[model samples]
Target chain A: AAGVIQSPRHLIKEKRETATLKCYPIPRHDTVYWYQQGPGQDPQFLISFYEKMQSDKGSIPDRFSAQQFSDYHSELNMSSLELGDSALYFCASSPMGTRADTQYFGPGTRLTVL
Target chain B: DQQVKQNSPSLSVQEGRISILNCDYTNSMFDYFLWYKKYPAEGPTFLISISSIKDKNEDGRFTVFLNKSAKHLSLHIVPSQPGDSAVYFCAAVTSYGKLTFGQGTILTVHP
Candidate 1:
């Protein structure tokens, strides 16, 4: 089965710079979720979308924004990046209806802010 | 405030023994609970889940028990093997598919 796909498995950026991460959810999956895992910490919910529409929000920072495209893929854009933003960014997907709560995660994108 | 908590940071068990990991949650609104197993440098893999209406769920060698009244859940791995060594996380969901995760517990199964 095809799993969620994330771009730039590893990313390096400098302070005050901008970065964009992309995610391609599993085929037919209509819900996309973003999470961040800091060093020595568990994954934290950032945001989520359903069928290209904003569905729920979490602890995402003001400097970060995300949107799901018509193709069911999503992008997370971070501006004025800070060193503290360095962490493993994960994208997960799930089908709607009965299996909506069952999310399958991608490998994750490791962001390193220098 | 932290909604989910896994008090034990680590657990060591001999191979072929049963491994039990516990989790507690403060939010009563959470209606669904799941257990995820994660290896280093990898994303969390869903192991098993239990609905609020169900007291337990089992899959192969893994089982999840829910104590709704106590707001607690636990995962049991029978006859644990060395390959089962990994970090286990407990997650809860209320609505909108947002998962609140607990601090993971590292399980070390020694052969």
Candidate 2:
């Protein structure tokens, strides 16, 4: 059972800088979701995509953008990063719409904005 | 506003005892509820889920009881083990794949 794969398990950036986080979902999984969890807080939905199409949106900031590539992989790009953006960024995948968002999560990428 | 709420911030129990966690939701449109366990510095892992149609769902030692009238839900772990120690989050799905999560409750099962 291959789980979701995320790149750069940890990222450190300065305010006003840019960072790109990548995610490779499980095989045959068509839906990808991004969540941000601040310290001692619940995971907050950022955005989601299904089959390279934007399916739903959440509390994602305007400075952040994401896209699911043809390979079913996705990337979250954050520009003009702020210190408040520091949190654990998680990527989750689901097999298909049938599961109705029974997501399997990746280990997550911890972003630290200095 | 937070639709889902987990009032207890933490709980501790001895091994072999039962651990119960409570959750409440304000959204009546939510049709499904899920429980996820997360360790420090790790992503949440799905534990159990129940549909709005059912009042109770059991999986091994884990059981989830839903009370639609009260708009409440609870997760029970029987014969708790130290391995069960972690933070538990309750999530609700109204439609699509979007999930709204509640503040988690940390459970510590001491051996």
Candidate 3:
């Protein structure tokens, strides 16, 4: 019954400002993923973390960065946000290192960059 | 280069009828597939999954069929209900757990 958890359920920021989103993976889950969902679009992979290290980054801009702490909590930071950055950010977690593992998603953080 | 593709943007079906949502993938390396359902403002929830080794997987009213040869997969919801209305996404895993998702298909089951 473990599920992913994200904070700051909704955020509004001006362009050129900074935004940070947090995610806590289920206990014992080893992989954490970040995705961005545009309005009426499917989720797009942003980045992933495994074993407290960045495993992979999707085709995201350099302004976006992510970190995973010792407790498997991950933070995605966007510096100098743009209006295009406005989207629902989702955090997901899966067991171990396999890609076939089922991922559990958190109620996403809706970011609106004005 | 969209590896996963959901050609249909939306589908409508009467309640108690069968609803079929289709997805196609261009990546032959994909070994696992999954379907997810999402409401208006919530994150997607897992609905069903199938491995490349299997042709079909079923649970309750939902069934997923995978055709490895054609690089296609489909989700069938039997006796669809109003509550079954949501956006459905098809995802493929080529590497371990990282997924490539297709544009979702919005399904509306009318009463």
Candidate 2's residue-wise lDDT over A27-101, tens digit each?
999999999999888999999999899999999999999999999999999999999999999999997845543
Which pairs clash in model 2?
Answer: none
- Model 1, B42-96: lDDT tens digits are 8899999999999999999999999999999999999899999999999999985
**Candidate 1 TM-score over all chains jointly:** 0.98
- Among all windows of 10 consecutive residues in model 2 chain B, the one with the lowest summed lDDT is B91-100
lDDT of 1 by residue, A58-91 (tens): 9999999999999999999999999999999999
Q: What is residue B94's positional error in candidate 3, in angstroms?
A: 0.5
Candidate 3: stretches off by over 4 Å: A97-101
Q: Is candidate 2 or candidate 3 better by TM-score?
A: 2
Specify the highest-DockQ model's number. Answer: 3
Please give the C-alpha DockQ score of model 2: 0.71
lDDT of 3 at A8: 92
Per-prediction backbone clash count: 0, 0, 3
- Candidate 3 chain B: 10-residue stretch with minimal lDDT: B92-101
Candidate 2: stretches off by over 4 Å: none
Global lDDT of each candidate: 0.94, 0.94, 0.91
Relative to the unseen true structure, what is the Cα RMSD of model 1?
A: 0.9
**Candidate 2: lDDT of A61?**
98
